[model samples]
Target chain A: MIVGDRKPMDEILEMLEPYENILILGCGTCVTVCLSGGEREAAILAGQLRIWGKKEGKNLNIMEHTIQRQCEKEWVDEMRGHVEKADVVLSLACGVGVQLVAEMYEEKAIYPGLNTTFMGYPVVHGTWLENCRGCGNCVLAHTGGVCPITRCAKSLLNGPCGGSQDGKCEISKDTECAWQVIYERLKKKDQLDWMNSYQPPRDWSTAGDGGPRKSVKIEEVID
Target chain B: MEADEATSTSEVPEEFRPRIVAYCCNYCAYAAADLAGSMRLSYPPDVKVIRLPCSGKVEISYLLKALEEGADGVMVAGCMEGDCHFMEGNFRAKRKVRHAKRLLEEIGFDSQRLEMFNLSSAMAGRFAEIILEMTERIKKLGPTPLRKGVKD
Candidate 1:
């Protein structure tokens, strides 16, 4: 899931200073799972904004709404009425959702309320760790399940660099060495021979190097 | 939502009294408040006690909504540390209170208006003292700046 963090109150307030009717749109997918931008968060932010407005003597009208997925057109289209009512929109979704909403609205001034952090999963109850870099390549077959591209500090194709100490990365003691984890995992599965197979340099072109990347769905009918 | 019927004590003027909401867990703080009442301990009437199953149930929104809806001060009272009936409920509440405080501060509101207290069910006198302390603190701070027309 794509994790996000709410932008500071100061930044949000500054962006909203000129607007009176504000719509706080929250996405219920990834942002909800990460507890950053969800229905509850949208409502909380609306409340905070209302309180701030009262204190600052601003006659602000704020509406809070959450859709199942802001990235999809159908879900965003359903909120057309609410969108049209507000003078400005504060999107609590990720960058993808925010862009999709902006594209759909075209004329409305859409602003992001969250800083889209990374494609990660919760390692613990409250801790999330990035596990995939979406390098446009699959190397899990050669290495273990761990992705060196995301977990490794250096993204070494073949690693356990000079900084791998006591199974921890050189960058931080809290970070587990991806290469160490890969080695240990493969060793446990009795597939250490795969380590001897050297991998060539990664191709960056497919990973949005030239421009934006897209995956078109090609439908096939049964003969 | 269980506020005292009396808005102010006999000495303080009604205008000077602050509207405080205290969320007390049934296992400890609520019991302590009850004991204080039975013992005839006279605390200020500014505080209104709302009972909860556990302090951990006090969500951040509740604290924010309290202030947003005209509460001058808010308090979350739970079991003493290491003595939570649900085991770690108070600890969770402590963290939530800290997070709420940060949120309040970030919104340019006074974080001092929100607080958390921990005491056993047997601490009747301590319950009265906590109320008095919160009441005095709020008195010094004055009414919440978030008050609708007053600030506007």
Candidate 2:
């Protein structure tokens, strides 16, 4: 899942200051899983704004709602009536959910409440970190099931560079050189010979070469 | 309480009472309180009950708003184990209570004041006991310092 955290509440208030009435939308899918932009969070944000606005005598009328999956058009349309009446929408969803809501309501000003971090898993309660870069390639079989490209600081294909003395990476005392992992893994598999065989340079065209990328299947469109 | 945001706590009389919005389920806690009253048992007059269909409908945001509006604390009382008027409403209420505790803790609250209690309607005395207990607890914790001293 893509991990994210809510933007500061101060920043959110600044963006929504112009609007007296606002509808805050929450997503029930990935954002809910990460516990960033969910129904509970949406309501909490709305309540906070109301209290603050009232304290400042700012006539801020706010309401909150959550959809099953704001990333889908079907789910986004469910709150059409609520969205139409509000002066603005504050989305408590991931980057994708924010975009989906914005695209659905072209005229409404949709603001994001989170900064999307990366593709990863929840390590434990309230802790999430990046684990995959989704380079559109899979070389886990060649290495020790760890992608050196993402984990390694140098992205060394076959390494244990001269700087690496112990098991840790040369760049930092904390990090384990991914090449060390690869060496140990290949050694365990009795396939150390594969290490000597130079791997061709990584194909840059397939990996982050252009600007932003997209993953889509025209055939799989909303079936 | 003082949702007006203008009435300063310092300006109020010590005897000035706090208003609490209690969401009590009809099955157990609400009836339990009524039984206490009918039986001439005394309890604090701070709470104003909002009879809810179930404790499950008590969102944490409501609790937060109660506190934000200057209620000393909010207590959610549900049915005793497996005795809900609506099956599993109290169970869902239990989950909401735990989640609310976590949220309040994250936002720098001790969360002891915001609480959930479970009891059967037969335990009217116990319901009265919990209200007294929670109310006393909040009184000791003092007014929510965040909402206090607003420089008028």
Candidate 3:
């Protein structure tokens, strides 16, 4: 799931000072699973805003609602009535959801309540660690299912870098060396020969470095 | 329902009783609470215990919700480190508790109101001590500013 963290309440309060009627929008998908911008989080944020507003005598009117997936146009459309009533929409979704809402409702003011951190899943209940960098290319086949692009500090392609000491990354003793993990896994699978092969340079064009990327399926689209 | 109404109105005490919510893991802390009961240890009645299958099941939202719903303080009691029934559930809960504390501090609340404790089922005495210690600490902190009738 896409992992994110709520922005500090101070910043959110500041952004909301200009608006009297605020809508706290939540996404029911990725952000919900990561425990960042879910329905419960949206409601809590609304409660917090109300407390702050009362303290400051702002007379803020806040409404809380959650959609199945804020990234989809249909789901966003379902919130049209509430959106139109709100002076400003405080989106608790990821960055994608915020932008999508802004694009869909061009005249309305949209603000992000969360700082979209990374594409990852919860390792346990509350701890989320990044696993994918969305580099547009996947090389997990040769690397024993461990992603160097996201795990390795330097994103080294071939093997362990000089900074790898005692199977830990040089960036921090807490981080395990990605290449070391790959090596151990490959050794167990008797695929150690894969390590000797040098991978070619990654294609930058397929990645988002060029520009905004899009995927289209003509068969699924209807005019 | 009648009893609840009586407690809320006619039976209301002049003294302020801090409302506390304790999320205890069923595998360890919950068992310890039961053991404390069997041993006949007396702890504060201010605390309300909610048991979960594992400490990791306790989410930050639940802790925040407790405060939002008028809890003066919230505590997470889990298994000792390296002793979680589900391997790293206690470690995960610790991280979440730390994160929740930071969030509370950011929102201008006393971060000490939220805490995490580690113990085994055998430590029934320690469990009772924790409840008393937390109750006293919260009494000093007074009602949460977010609580109704409490002014900033």
Candidate 4:
């Protein structure tokens, strides 16, 4: 999932200053899974903002609602009625979810409440670490399930860069060498042979060709 | 463990009884605690029970906020491992508890302070025992530094 974390409260407040009626839209999927923009988070942020709004004596109407998946058009479309009534939308979803909201409602303003980190998992409760760059291509097959692109300090496709010292990355003592982790993981799985093959630099087209992008999205195409 | 650092709540509990918080699944753990009440089983009142529809509904931040407010110890009580009013509620709750334990430890709070338990709704005695155990553990640890003046 595309991992994200909330932006500073001041930033959010700044964005909402122009609008009178606001909606704090949340996602129930990936961002929710990573504990970023979810129903619970939406409620909490709403409560907090309301308290802040009251202290400032500003007449702010902040409504909180969560969708099943903000990335999906169908889910976003459900809010058309709600969206039309609000002056601006404060999306708690990831970056994609924000874009989708923007796409869904062209006339209204949409703002992001999260800083859309990298794709990661919950290392533990409330803790998230970046794992995937979502370069549009996945290379998990060669790296023994670990993605050096995201986990490695250098995003090295090859084995540990010489910066590793005593199994730790030179970038930081606390961080483990991604290549070493791959080595051990591959060894455990008896897939070290996969590492012997060489790979060239990753293609950037899938990452940032920097143009209007479109996907086939076969499932969404109805007869 | 990461949640503590992430939520920035761990540092808030610098001292005191370390307000203990528990999220109890209304179907199981809450009922168990009620059973303890009926049975007259005694446990410390420092721990506050926040009833949840299911442990699954309790988010990581919910627990973090509790700890930030000086909850010295936290626990999530759910239905038995195999039985949940909402399938996998306890399972997810357990995962959350484990993650919370790690987060608390990462923030300098003892990981033991956050715990997860699975019990049948009928097992009230077990609930009292768990509460007593958690209270004793927190008492030994003393007040959480953050809780010394947490806003609540």
Per-residue lDDT of A52 in model 2: 63
- lDDT tens digits, residue span A118-138, model 1: 999998887899988788987
lDDT of 3 by residue, B38-114 (tens): 99999988889999999999887788778766787899999999999999999989988997787666656667778
TM value for model 2 = 0.67
A200, model 2: CA deviation in Å?
A: 3.2
Worst 10 residues of 4 chain A by lDDT: A48-57
Worst 10 residues of 4 chain B by lDDT: B1-10
Stretch of 10 with least lDDT, candidate 1 chain B: B1-10
> What TM value does chain B of candidate 4 have?
0.81
* Candidate 3 local lDDT, A1-223, one digit each (tens): 8999999787898898789999999999999999789998897788667655543446778899999999999999999999999999999999999999999999999999999999987777679889998888899999999999899988888869999999999899989999999999999999999999999888767768778889889899999
Off by over 4 Å in 4: A210-213, A217-223, B1-152
Number of the top-ranking candidate, with TM-score as the measure: 1
Q: TM-scores of all models?
A: 0.91, 0.67, 0.71, 0.61
Better of 1 and 2 by TM-score: 1
Give all candidate RMSDs, comma-separated: 4.9, 6.8, 7.1, 9.6
Candidate 2 clash figure, as a count: 0
Q: Give the CAPRI class of candidate 3.
A: incorrect
**Model 3 regions more than 4 Å off:** B1-102, B110-152
Cα lDDT over the full model 2: 0.77
Most accurate candidate by lDDT: 1
Output the TM-score of candidate 4. Answer: 0.61
